[model samples]
Target: MNHAIFEKNSLILLIGTLIVVSIGGIVEIAPLFMIQSTIEKVEGMRPYSPLELAGRDIYVREGCYNCHSQMIRSLRDEIERYGHYSLAAESMYDHPFQWGSKRTGPDLARVGGKYSNDWHVEHMRSPRAVVSASIMPGYPFLAQTPLKAEHIEEQMRTLRIVGVPYTDEQIENAQADLLAQVSPEAPGGAEMQKRYPNAVFADSPSKAGVTEEDALVAYLQHLGVSVDFKLYDDKANIR
Candidate 1:
């Protein structure tokens, strides 16, 4: 065998490896940018509240990212299975986005207000009660532990730094937004009334449990509530 022929073959192999790696990188990243073009059409998108942001951080820190993805791609099976594919703007505020590829559990991009506080507590305590045959372990610690509210402002600051639009002016508006959507007949509404039946203060902030602190619960409870197959198409109506 010629030594020059062997050297030439090695160079060819190195070039091939670089080409393959480059293609793979582009394949993985290109779609995300394309998806950004579509996000311009999404409506009613907003930043997570301080407490909800805290809960999301907790969700991530607990390795919940290992099991769930925050992204819902545009696809028939994903729409049919998960209710609606997520929009690009939906997760625009997330740093290093939680759009995981592998889902050991479920998609939580829209898990807001899907269940009750008690249910979250219960599910965290024991998954089997809420989800029969769930392989996931219970997070009893989150329930026994009262959530630390110290980082409320700091968390909001972090979200704002990233891109969340929450501001001091928006707090009152957020409360009004929740009130308009929430039905007085709803289970949580009744509980809210029992506590702060009337607006005692024009801008004093809703009761401790009725505002953003509890908005985290509202977010967790409202998951999968927006997409109603009977109401609208899951895909963006953007031209």
Candidate 2:
């Protein structure tokens, strides 16, 4: 039988399996090589600020992706509920994009600017405090724990090596920016603001030092805000 050939000849089976897998991989990956030039970009899209990047790391570390998805599907219902559908250009800088397929909580594609920082803080401390039916757990400790940002520059440097386009100045000032983002009147914040116009500078009432809460809120407030969907031309992406 055909099965007997593979079962008896281990070397032949190994070679045959590798050949099949290679062919399958080639079929899946070759199209991307051919289509790389066809990629389109929208305006106002920029790399995440240092604070937001740190928050994104915390988001991943806390397994927030388990409950929430960042991707909004093209379906009409999804678009209506979560603003415009997600754009490839929006996720271009993501080392591993967060376009997850789970929906234990709502999609977060357009959650930016939807609620105030205070509301987010309250929600984070206890979701049910604001949303009575919420099943999400509280992260009260986030506000108490100071953000560990001394190595932010090194993180930015590593991201640059992976094609994030972080400039030398950005990497050099990463730690400053992280601290500046949580203080509206911080002297160093002026440069950070200039570098990131969309970045929100909030004053944390409870803590003098920036905390994990501040970083995560910054990241949440930065999502789905890079580009103006009204100005976007959907046809340009079709190839």
Q: What is each predicted model's overall lDDT from 0 to 1?
A: 0.56, 0.85
Write the residue-wise lDDT of candidate 1 on 1-239 in tens digits: 55665477988768877999999999998888867454554444446544345555666677777888877777776766766667565666676577887899888876655555656656767889999988899776554454455545655666677666766644433344344323343234433333322211112123333332233344454344433434446356523
- TM-score of each candidate? 0.60, 0.83
Report each candidate's C-alpha RMSD, comma-separated, in the order given. 8.3, 5.3
Winning model by TM-score: 2
